[model samples]
Target: MSNIIARFHKIQVQDGVKVWYREAGAAGNPTILLLHGFPTSSNMFRNLIPLLAEHFHIIAPDLPGFGFTETPENYTFSFDSLCESIGYLLDTLRIEKFAIYIFDYGSPVGFRLALKFPSRITGIVTQNGNAYEEGLDDRFWGPLKKYWKSYQSDPVFVQSLIPYLQDPANVIRQYHDGVADIESVDPAAYTLDIALIQRSGQADIQLRLFFDYQNNIKLYPAFQRFLRDSKIPVLVAWGANDTIFSVAGAEAYRKDVDDLKVVYYDTGHFALETHVVAIAEEIISMLAENQGY
Candidate 1:
C-alpha cells in the first residue's frame, strides 16, 4: 500500500488548491477518471487503480476538501464549486475526454461535469451513485434532513457529527453495511482514511457541505436530461448490499440511457474494494466496446 501511494503525483488545480491524484498507463490510452464519495479520497481507488492501469490510463483525484487537497477557509464548498474545480483539473491535465467511475458524492460531481461538457464524456461506470428518489430515503436521511434544514442556526450541532467521521469502528461499520464481502477490505486502508479525515478540517467541511447537498439534489433532473439526450454509453456496477443508497438507484440509470448495462457485485457502498479485479475488467471491456480498443 505504501508503494502504491508513492506512485501518485500531487498536482495543484485551480486557485492553487493542491489536488492529490494518481495516473498510470500510457497518456494516449483511453482515460478513466475515478471519482470518490464523501469522507474518502483517491485512496478509495488505491487497490483498484493499479489493476485498471494495465488496461487503460486511470486518473483518481481527491476532491477539494477531501484527502490531501487543501481546502482554503474562504473557499465555498458547494457542489458547483466542486464541479468547476474538477473541470479545471481535467483542463490542467489536458484530458479532452474520459469515462468516469462515480460513487457516492462522485455521482453529483461527475454528473455535473458530464452535463457541463456532454461531448467530453465517453462513458460512465457507477457503483452506488444514487440518482433515484428511493435512494434518497435512508436511516441517515432523517438526521441529514434535519441538519440541512437548520444548519445555519445549529452549526455546532452539525460539527458534532465529526466524531463519527473520525471513529474507526463507525467507519468500519459503514463499509461493512455497504459492502457485501467485508473480508476483502484492508483494515489499514480504513486507518489511513481515518487519519486523512482527522489530519485537516475535512470533517468540518463535509458537515458544512451536507447542508448544501440540496443544491446538487435539485440538479438530478438536469443530469437525467443529459443522459437522455446524449449518446454516451453507461454501465452500472452496483454493490447489492449497499444499505445507504439501495439497489433502486442502480435501476434509475436505465430510464435515461439507451445503452445501459448493470453488474451487481456482492459488496456494499465501497464495492470497488472487494470487486476491483472484476470491476477493472468491466471498465476495460466497456471502453473497448465503445471506443474500439
Candidate 2:
C-alpha cells in the first residue's frame, strides 16, 4: 500500500497571487505538474494525486481566481497572464524541469509553457485538454462564441450567459454530460465547483478567460508544431463522453506527436472522478516510458 499523503500548500508568486497547490511524493522523484480546468481547481486532482504520489512528485495548483488562489486587485486574467504567473510559481519552487498533466482550461496554459520553455517540459499528459480546432465543438462553444461578439457592444448579452454559467445545475451538467450512468457521478465534484463559482468576482474572472480563450485556439497550430519538432512524449487520456472536447480532439494530437498513447474512458469531462485508478495507472506507465524506467 502506498503511504503517501497529499499535502495542501500555498505559494505567493511574483505578482502576488497566492496559488494553492497539492504536493506529494518525494522531493527528487520525477515531477508532474497536474493542472485542473474550468470551474474546478487543483481539487479535481484529489483522487489522482495520492495514487501517483507513491512514485512521482505531484504538484497541482489552483490558478489565480480559482479555488483558494487569491485574485489580487487589478490583476489581468488573460491566458498569457496566467501562463506567466504559472511560470513564476514553477521558478519560485526551484522546479527546473517537469512534466505537465493538463485538463480543459489547463490545455492552453500548459501548452504556452511547453512552447516558451520546451526544455523544461519532460512530457505531457492530457485528459481532455484540447490542442486542435475541432476540439471546440459548437454545442459547447456556440453560446460563448456569441457572447464574445456582443460582450463589447451589448452588456445585456454577457449578462444572459452569466446566470447559466453560474447556475449549479449547469455546472452539474458539465460534469455529467457524456456519462451514461449519472448515478456514479459524485456530487462533490460540482458541489465544490459551485462553491468556487460563488466567490466574489469569480464569474467575471472566468468570463475574461472565456473571452481570451480564442487566443488559445489561435496557438493550436503552434502547439502542434512544438509537439512534432520537440518530440515530446505525450499521453492523451480522455473521457470518450466529453461533450465540450470530443474524441476527435484526442486523435488530433497524432498529427504532430508520434510518441503518443491514447486511452478513452466511458465517463464525461470529469473522467478522474470515475477513472482515477485507470488514469493514474496509465500515467505511471507513460512517465516511466519517458524516463526509461
Candidate 3:
C-alpha cells in the first residue's frame, strides 16, 4: 500500500457543512471521481486509487456526516444535500468534466450530481450501485425497513448495529460473501477498513441514512431519465454474488442507459477489493474506447 497519508481537504457547503475529500494522481489527466458507499469513506478506494492514478486524476470525497467530514445537527443528510456538496467540491476543484465511479451509497449521490449537471459527466462506472428493484433484497434490509418505520422511538436498537459494521469477523464474512474468491483479498485492507469505520463514527450515519433511503429511491426514475436522455457512456462492473445488490440490479443499467457495457465478476458488494486490477484495466479500456487514452 502507498505510504501517502491520503490527505484530506474540506470545503464549505450548504448551511456551513464542511465536506472533506482526498485527491490523487496528476491534475492534468482525465479526472475520475470515486464516490464511496455507507460506513466507508474515500478510504474504500485506497488500494485502487494508486493504480488508476497512473492513468487518471482521482478524487474521492467523504460525504457529510460520514468519515472525517463534520455535519451540523440541523443539516439533513439527504441525497439532495449530498449531491449539492459534491457539486460544490467539483466546482471548487475547477473540474469541468469527469467520469464517475459509483458504488453503494455513492450511487444516489453521484446520480443526483449527474442529474444536476449532465454535461459535466462524461462516463460512469457502476459497481453494486443498484438503481433497480432487485438490488434491495438482503438481510440488511429486513432490520433497516423496521428501523426506518420507527427510528424516532427505537434509535438505540438502530444504533446497536454500528458495532457490526466494524466487526472484523463480520468484515471477513462480508468480503467472503461478496468476493468470487476470498483468498485473493488482502486481510489488512479489511482490517484497515474496519479501523477507519470504527474511528469515523460512520456507522451511526449509515443507520440514519438507511432510514432516509426511500427519498433516494424516489429519485431513481429521475436518474434513469437523465441517463436515457443524455446518452452518457456507462460501464457496469458488478459483483454477481452481491447479496445486497444482486445481479439483477446490474442488468437494470441496460434498461436505463443506451450506451452501457457490462462485465460481471464473481464477487459481491466490494468487488473492487478482490478484482482491483481487473476493474482498473476495464475502466481504462472503457475510457480509452470512448474518450481516447
What C-alpha lDDT values do all the predictions have?
Answer: 0.80, 0.88, 0.80
Local accuracy of candidate 1 as per-residue lDDT tens digits, 72-180:
6788888888888888889999999899999998999999999888999989888888766767746756778887877779877677777866777777776777654
User: Whose TM-score is greatest here?
Assistant: 2
How do all models score by TM-score? 0.92, 0.97, 0.88
Q: What's the count of clashing pairs in each model shown?
A: 6, 0, 1
The 10-residue segment with the lowest total lDDT in model 1: 1-10
> lDDT: which is higher, 1 or 2?
2
Off by over 4 Å in 2: none
Candidate 2, residues 218-293, lDDT tens digits: the string is 8998898989998878999999988899899999988888789999999889999888999999998988655674
Model 1: lDDT to the true structure: 0.80
Candidate closest to the true structure, highest lDDT: 2
- lDDT, candidate 1, residue 159? 71
Tell me model 3's lDDT, rounded to 2 decimals: 0.80
C-alpha RMSD in Å of predicted model 3 compared with the true structure: 2.9
Better of 1 and 3 by lDDT: 1
